[model samples]
Target chain A: MIRVNNITKTFAEREIFSNVSFSIPDAKIYALVADNGVGKTTLLRTIANIYNADSGNVVSSAKVSYLPEERGLPLEQKVFDFLLFVAQLRGMRKKIAKTRITDLLKKYSLFEFADFYIGNLSKGMQQKIQFLSVIIDNPKVLILDEPFSGIDEKNKELFWEELLELKNNGASILISAHKTDDLTHFCDAFLLFDGKSIEMVDSLQLQVEQK
Target chain B: MINSIRIIWLVAKNEMKQMFRQRLFVFLLFILTICAISDPGKENLYFMFFVLNFSMALFRSIASEKESRLAEYYISIFSPTKLLLGKIKAYAIFFFVISLLINICAVAGLLRFVDVSFLPCVSMLCGWQVFVQLLGCVFYLSLVAFGASYSRVHTEMQGSIFVIAILMVSSYFVVENLADIFGNVLLCETLLKYIPFTMPFVKGVGILPMCVSFVAIIFILKFSGKIYKKRLFYYGKNKITEG
Candidate 1:
């Protein structure tokens, strides 16, 4: 569903990573594990077309929903307003967006928090809101950076459940997480991210190309 | 594009919330009205000038979020052109409401004190002022949006370069007024021709200036859209996005 070749990103004359290349298989959970500034988010940006590749190309057949590790949620935002905005952006109508947001809120036990300002909630809760903002749309591909950081264990578990359900429902997932141990269970394969090199990581065969 | 529009509206609606969340909007209107009404005779024009400066300062606050990473979340997703348009739309509505209130106040205050003939000046003055301010907002935010998109540090301050630029561009207008004291209307006319800001305004009985403003908006919109398209590194100065 996605192919990236020799994608290089630099900031301030310093190279973040170079010659990064990979292809995400259809309907599989692809985990891109790396330390901060190792070009994980930059790589995702390239795939999402937020940042262009310096010397390579990323070809993707699926629409992508990108979730950055940062606190992307506006704290003063209302849950309904926030989710509805995201849903509508993915091309949902206002009424459909409203209905979808209501269902997601209730399903996630966020019904009571729907009207609460994001800033008034705990950081974990706010993170969930941010996640919902992206996931509510159900894009063909999900690219997440640090998807499990900063949330409560319960919320984290809920995220895993939701992710597995998404995967089962034919959505390809690519994620970067701090906890490499928990990833072995669901993530079919990963990209090894060191400071200068992003290696294709698999007990199975992996493709490599340089731009 | 629908996605872009929805996202822009969300961000803009939130921006409006932020505007109202702070008491500054109401405070500015209140202070301006009080100043206009309390003025004594022709001295009110002096107060009116102060109101202009105050409004400029108030409107500049709209760019504050872009200066900070506060707007970054949405910035990462939407096209820069749409983002700029949405923010400007919200600010336009804000300025329109404020302009309406200020116009009403100015007309009432002027009728109560200055020559009642000043009533005719209301529509013209307010129209010109609103147009000029809108021009300033567009010009300033276009650059600020660039700074936010590209600059690595202290973008808030970097965004002010646009505001300072407006000041510099309009500085020639000031010179024309001062030169008139010496009955140097010819020199003022000649100087105004070469000056960038004055040139646009007087090229054809305000038509040139209006056309220039509209053209400038299209230019900025086109440029920002190009950045959204072919440009890899936006925050045009920021290399972070350079692949």
Candidate 2:
């Protein structure tokens, strides 16, 4: 479980958020819905502890991972070389991580492109590899900021399946986006920001539970 | 320890791939080789130095991603320290190989055509060039990595580190190369051994500075990690963590 209490952040003179607070229960998929430039990325960064909040406390386990809203791949790095590196940084051995990379590359349907550099691949392919860089480690607190933004419908379906698998295994997901309908299937509840504060749609029923 | 090694290893491997495989890395190698071989006599060292600084700047651009907003994705999974090690290690290798290449070309050209036995000198000179350039590269790499880590702009890493290169080179020469006294006379040569940077040159390509260099690397390894954790400055602004 992740508990965020009274968090606030500002950029220069602009206030991004003010004492916003919420809790993400274990095994729950919380979609952070808001229009653009409302500090969606900032909030996700704060949650990932990549950005320190001006006020409030964020409590969570150490087993957390974040997928930034922007592209982070080293364009010259081959797909397999990159993800194995991420796994290593998070405490996996090189040999062990390389073995895992083989499994993940195939699973992501990237087996053919495993040796190909990211710059040579399409955006969605790179994005999927970027996602694989995080998910290969099996983070308990899975934070993805606008991961679906640039992906096509077919690729999004592939991502949805991988994410749903994580959710079923008791992962807590924090996803921020402008589109609500595309994510209605897996989101257990919704968190909305109206540019001032954050409010959770606590009573919304999950598709499975409602059925 | 193992995890950090793995990350750093991958970082070095990736950088080597970029330096060797891509059309750009190959183009750079060709340009640098032309510069190294085409120059006449000891003047080649001057061209090699230009190539040295050029390669350093190039690697800086490649290594700057770890410092920018682009770093946000990777930094979440890897600690700032591990990330720093990876980048530092990668760029160091880039500088190392290219500088070694320069040293070899210079020595071989001096020995083959001029008959100075660069092969006899390669062991001593390679040792000196590798360790010295490696040290210089890490110092620059750390500064760039820190700037990139703290900046929203990825390209800022290149600018920030490069702008300080003149100062860095000045310091490196004044402190490190000053010791040899450029192989001068007896009275001065005796005293040169006592000056830290000057004294290492008396060892004449021994492990003297190499040992000290390792200590400095460890110091950077330990200090930068603490700086990021206690001070959340990676957001392009400083925010102290208050309990």
Candidate 3:
């Protein structure tokens, strides 16, 4: 479980957000819905500890993984090697990391291209690798910012299946994406950012309101 | 403590693996090897080349990571201190090997002029040179890392690299003439030997510079680690000014 207590953030003498608080319970996915230039990415980054809040704190002992909105990948690195290093950095043993990476690649049908440099892959494939790196460790708290911006529908479906699997295993996910139709199906709740704060709304209630 | 060390090692190993494949780095190594082998009597010039080459490589590595925003990802996932240490560790190992090779080449060049019986003395001298060069390289690289962290763009870092190179050359000149200014050769030598930039050019092995270099490394890493933590997430807007 992730508990965020009245987190406030400011930058460059401007308030990005103030007094925002929410908690993500285990075994569920939450969609962060907000228009561009809003505090969606900033809020996610704060929760991931990439950016510190001006006040309050995030309390979670569970292992967390983050996928930034921008593609934060080393183009020079091969897919398998990159994922293996990330796994090891996350404190997994090398042998286990290697095996886990191999299994993931096979499952994703990327085994043949595991040795290819990430720069050589298509945009969708590269984004797929970025997502794979995040989920490789089965993080208890997964935070994603605009994770599905430029991918095709097919890959998006594949990602949703994997995210559901992770959720079933008791991981809490906070994902912000442009595609609400895709997220509305499986995401257990929606955290709507209104440029100043976040309001948590149930998925069923959100669906009824959308109707 | 053990886990921290392990994290550093893992980062270092990964960095080394990736760097080996960089075409620019391979080209730099080729040029360095040629310079080391071709220049015989100019050890000071060779040391400058060493500084320029390694510092550029280090700067390029840091700059590219920043440009690509990969540094942000690494910082988000792992502590910046461990990541920086790991990067420095890898560069230190690379610098040590290259310095050793350069010293070996210099000693080999001396083979043509020195007496055959003095080969053992030359080898011992070469060993001392390698030790001193390693220390000097680490010192300069740490400074380079510090400068690279604060630079907001590629041109800015390029300017910083040139400034650092000049500072290195100036250190050699200062250390060489300090005795004349002080009118006491022994005292000057004792004090000036602690200057890491002078370590590679010194004729004999001295312990002062080694101690000084270790302290400088620790202090600089601490200072730079703080800068890195602050600057790692800063995605500043780049704008051109009107003339």
Candidate 4:
């Protein structure tokens, strides 16, 4: 489980969010919804420890996998090498990392381009690679920021399936996306960030309200 | 500890692979090696050039990571200390191997072309100079890396790189004319020899200054890590950590 307790973040005296508190239990997926600059990405980063919360803490019992919103993978690195490097940094042994990366690539139909430079791939292909890197180590908790930004409908379906698999495997996932309609279909609940605080609502409740 | 070492080694290996993949970088390394043997008398100038070039590399690496937001992702995986030390370790190995090769080639060129009789004296002097200069390279590189942490983009690194380049060049000139600059003050000369920037060039000093350089390197690297951690996620003057 991942628990964010009373987190606050401000930039240059401008308060983005304050005392934001929420939790994601095991084997569930939650969507973070907010308008642009409303601290959706910032909240995700704080949980991932990429950015420290101003007045609170995020507590996770195990390794947390994070996929930043942007295309931050090293362009010069080959896909396999980049994944291996990240896995090792996350404390995975080389043999296991290699095995898992291969399996993931094959599953994603990216094994043919395993040795290709990441910069050479199309935008959607690169997004797939980035997502593969995120799930390579079987993380216990995941914090993904706008992971569906640059992909097509078919790839989006693939991602949803993968996320469902991860959730069913007892992983806690917190994902932020602009499309609440897509998230309502599978996400267990929603954490709506409205600039000052967060309100947790059940996914069924969201669908009902939308109807 | 072993895990940390493994992580550092992985980072270093990755960096080495990335650098070697660049044909221009490889060509430059070749040119540098050739230059070392062709002009043994200008080894001091070569050392300065090496510092300048590698400092640029460090600046570019750090700046580009910040610009591309890759540093943010890296920070989440490992401590900034590990990332920075891994980077420093990669360049240290590169500098050590290349400089050792250059020293060997310069000595070989001297024996074959200049004078065989000068072997004993030249060997001892070159040996000590190489050791001292290696320490100097790490020291300066750490300083540059620390300064590079302040930059948010590649272009923003110009101010720090300029200042560091000037410091490195001035240190070279200062070492070249030590006697003229100090003018017979033994205590002053001894003190100057311990300053991390010039310590690499001042020979004949004992192990004490070497230890001092080690301390300086450790201190600089630790401070650099702290700065990097602070700057990595910072958006502006608000100081995100303090928000």
Candidate 5:
């Protein structure tokens, strides 16, 4: 379980969010919905420990994998090299990282481009690579920010399938996006951000509202 | 400690490979080779050439990461100390290689003009050249890294360049007229001794200055690491706390 207690954040004297408290239970998908510039990314980053909250604290007992909205990978590295490096950074052994990366590449049909530099790959392919890095280690807490931004329909399905599989395996998944419709089927609950704070809404109610 | 070393080594290797791939590095290196061959006997010119080239190299190595926002990813994974150490180690290796090549060329040129009997002196001179260049590289690189850490994309490159220029000019002026400025104050003399690359050439390189340079390098590295951590991890309108 992950508990966020009264987390507050501000940038340049402007408050992004304040007194934001929530809990993420195991084996559940929490959809974070907010408009652009409304602190969706900031909230995810805070939970991932990338950004520190001003007045609150977060407690978690699980391994975390965060995919930020911005893809800041080294473009000079080859696709395989980048994935392997990220795996190692996340504490995976060299032999395991290499084997898992190879399998991931083959599974995602990226095997042919393993040796190709990431800068040469398409935007969608790069996004997929980033997504793969997050799930490669089967982290207990998966925080994905705008995971479907540049992905195509087919790749989006692949991502959803993998996310659901991870969720079924008891991963606490917090995914944020502009469009909530795509996540209606997978998310267990919806956390609505109204610029100042967040409120939890039942997934059933969110589905009915969408209807 | 072992884990940190491994992380540093990995980061350094990757950084070195990425640096070597850049066309700018290759171009500058070729130009520096020509300059080294042409001005082998002119110590000041050679030193200036190294200062400028290595300063630019260190600046680009760091500033480019900030420009591309890649530092964010690495900072999230590794501690600031590890990241800084990795970069310093990588650049140290780079400086060592370049210095070795230039020393070889310079020594060859000297041998052509001088006699074979001065071989031992030539060897010692080459070794001293590596030490001086490495010390200079680390000092400038640390200063530039500290500067680059706090700056964003547009300003980081220019900021590092400005810092290197200012330090190079100010250190030269201060070292040249140390006695005139401070008038034999023991404390001032003691402090000046620790400034790397500031000592005058005597019969040979002084042991005291070499030890001082090593200590100075450590101090600069520690100071830079602190700055990097504060800049990278704790940047917001409010105080950031770790859980």
Candidate 6:
């Protein structure tokens, strides 16, 4: 479980959000819905500890894997090598990491592109590779920002399947998505961000309200 | 402790692979080899070339990582200190290998002029030269890492590289050529004596500059690690305010 206290963040005298607080329970997916510039990315970054909050703290004992909205992958790195590096950096042993990466690639049908440089892959393929890097180590807390932006519908279905499997196995997921319909069935709850703050709403309630 | 070392080793190995893949680096190595073999008499010029070549390599490696935002991934997994130390270790090894090769070329070139009887002394001198060069390269590369972290754009990063290179080269020239001018002034002479470049000329292996260089290396590494950590977390429009 992860608890975010009354976190406030501002950028260059502009307040992105204030007094935002929430908790992500284990074994469920929480969808973050907000319009552009509503601090969805910033909020996620704060939770991941990549960005510091001005006046709050995050409490979590679980190991975390964060996928930022902007991909920061090394373009020259081969897919297998890159995933191996990610796993190792996350504290996996080299032998285990190699096997885990190989299994992930095979499962995702990316085994063929293991030797190819990331820059040479298609956008969707690269997104899959990035996604694989995060999930390879089975992080306890998985935070994804716009995880489905570049992926195609077919891969999206596959991704949803994997995410559900992770959720079933008790991983806490916090994802930011603009498309509500796509995530209505997958998410257990929703955190709606206005220009000033965040509010939690049940996914079922959100669906009824949309109707 | 073991985990930290493993992290550093993995990062350093990957960085070395990336360095070897660059055509420009290969080309520069060729040029450095030629310069070392052809101009052994001008040891100062050769040393300057070594500094310039390694400085550029270090700067390019760091700047490219910054531009690509790739360091963010590593920063997310490990502490900024580990990341920076790993990079320093990688470049230190690179500098050591290249310095060794260049020293061999210089010794071979010098052999053509001197009698073979002086081979043992020449080898010892070459070893000392390589050690001093390694220390200088590590110090300069740490400075490069610090400077590169402040750059948010390619143009600014390029400008910083030139500034650092010029600063290093100019300081070496002033110290080597204008020693007499400084010698007359007590304060200037005192400051000049601490400069690491002048240490090589001092008889019996200048211990003072080596000590100064070692301290400077530690100071810069720690300072740069803090800056890098701050930059990684406090980016995107907000100036990092001191706590």
Query: Which number leads on lDDT?
Result: 4
Better of 2 and 5 by TM-score: 5
> How large a fraction of the reference contact set does each model reproduce?
0.19, 0.50, 0.46, 0.54, 0.22, 0.26
Give the per-residue lDDT of model 2 (tens digit) for A126-153. Answer: 8888788878877788888888876888
Decreasing TM-score order of the candidates: 4, 3, 6, 5, 1, 2
Q: Write the per-residue lDDT of candidate 6 for residues A97-131, one digit (tens) a residue.
A: 99888888899999999999999998888889888
CAPRI band for model 3: acceptable
Model 1 per-residue lDDT at A190: 75
Query: lDDT of candidate 4 vs native?
Result: 0.82
> Tens digit of lDDT per residue, candidate 6, span B42-127?
55566667667766776777666665666665666776667777877887887678678777887887788999999999989888
> What is the alpha-carbon interface RMSD for each candidate?
4.4, 5.2, 5.9, 2.6, 4.9, 2.9
lDDT at B148, model 5: 64
lDDT of each: 0.62, 0.67, 0.81, 0.82, 0.75, 0.78
TM-score (chain B) for candidate 4 is: 0.88
CA lDDT of A136 in candidate 6?
84
lDDT of 1 at B19: 57
- Candidate 6 reference-contact recovery: 0.26
Candidate 5 chain A: 10-residue stretch with minimal lDDT: A63-72
Best by TM-score: 4
- Rank candidates, lDDT, best first: 4, 3, 6, 5, 2, 1
* Predicted complex 6: DockQ: 0.36
User: Listing every candidate in turn, what is its Cα RMSD in Å to the true structure after a full C-alpha superposition?
Assistant: 5.8, 6.1, 3.5, 2.8, 4.6, 3.3
Chain A TM-score, candidate 6?
0.96
User: DockQ for each candidate?
Assistant: 0.28, 0.33, 0.46, 0.49, 0.26, 0.36
Please provide, for model 5 over A1-211, each residue's C-alpha lDDT reduced to its tens digit, 9 standing for 90 to 100: 6888999988767888899999999999998899998988878877877676888998886857788776676788899988888888778899999999999899899999999999999888888888898898888888888888878999999998999999889898988977678888889998989888788988899889878
Between the candidate structures 5 and 6, which one is better when assessed by TM-score? Answer: 6
TM-score for chain A as predicted in candidate 5: 0.96
For model 2, the superposed segments whose C-alpha errors exceed 4 Å read A93-108, A203-211, B22-69, B91-133, B144-162, B168-243
Per-residue lDDT for A151 in model 2?
82
